[model samples]
Target: MFNDISGKYDFLNHLLSFGIDKIWRNKLLGSITFASDSKVLDMATGTADVALQIAKEKGVEVTGADISDGMLDVGRVKVKTKKLEDLVQLVNGDAENIPYEKETFDIATVAFGVRNFQDLPQGLIELHRVLKADGQLRVLEFSKPKSSFVFWFFGLYFNRILPFVGKLVSKNNTAYRYLPVSVNAFPEGQDFCDYLRNAGFTEISFKPLTFGISTLYICKK
Candidate 1:
């Protein structure tokens, strides 16, 4: 599904969110407390945006993982274009069964990715397992709006207008439509914090962004 729209994913993402996704991503990056030698893992890192940005800012080794080859291919080109090959690497990997040894990474990030996990708990557990003690993990994802007016208007945009425009632009019928459904069905707030705690995360907390249109979860192992 992602492979089909990889070409348009970045553009539509910025367009659909009116570029607020970038601001949200910046918030996720700001949440990070980077070690001088932090080894970072970015799960479901479609197009490697976070991986590249972190590498550019911190000059650290970043491994970006995703299942979609089309997206990875795009990311690889960007890495090369930016001459960041030495700092960033993109690999094909699954979140639920990460291909790494225990306690290998100092930090991990998942931007708008966890809600797509086939097994959310297992994915979180894998993330915890791969992080060093005191390692930090940040997750940015869509959520329900808190304000009544925002909820009503955003619901109309999300359920109707967004998908319609997304289809016309991306020429993919199902991907955008599936997004709202997945976000709406996925757990949020304290319910999602419970999953993090179950996966052995400590100091689990989340803050809503853009009128609660999305959430950023901060956790430590």
Candidate 2:
């Protein structure tokens, strides 16, 4: 399903989100309090937008891994175009089975990608395994708004307006429809944070972004 729409993924993403996705990614990057020369792994890094932002803004070496070669192809082009081939590298790998050895990265990140995992707990455990002691894991994902009124409006837009626009632009109805379904199915708030804690991460915290339309989860191993 992901592979089929990989070509239009990035384009439809920006358009459907009204470019707020970029701002959300930047905010996720800014929330990272990593030191210089940090090594970061971006799991399910479609097109490497978040990974590229981290490398450019924080001078970190980023390895972006995704299961879809089509997405990686676009990411490779962007890396070369930005002259970040030396700083950013894209690899074909699975989030639930990262290719690197244990404790290999200073930080691990995933932006709007966790819900797609076939086995969410396995993926989180893999992310925990790859982080060095005290290293952080940052995840950005969609969440339903807490406010009833806001939630109603968001649901209307997300389930109706966004999918319509996405289908018109990307010509992939199932893919856009899956977006809202996935978000609705995923756990949110303390329920999600508890998953991190159970996976052996401490100092777990989450911040609601954009009036709870999205959330950023931060945790330490």
TM-score of each: 0.99, 0.97
With candidate 2 superimposed using the best TM-score fit, by how many Å does residue 31's alpha carbon deviate from the native? 1.5
Candidate 1 wrong stretches, greater than 4 Å: none
Error of 1 at 89 (Å): 0.4
Which stretch of 10 consecutive residues in model 1 shows the poorest summed lDDT? 28-37
Worst 10 residues of 2 by lDDT: 1-10
lDDT for 213 (candidate 1):
96
Q: After superposition, how far is residue 162 of candidate 1 from its true place, in Å?
A: 0.9
Candidate 2 lDDT, 1-221, residue by residue in tens: 67778788888888788899988898788778888879999999999998898888888899999999989998999999999988999999998999999999999999988989999899999999999999989999999999999999999999999888878877876888889999999998899998898889999999999989999998899
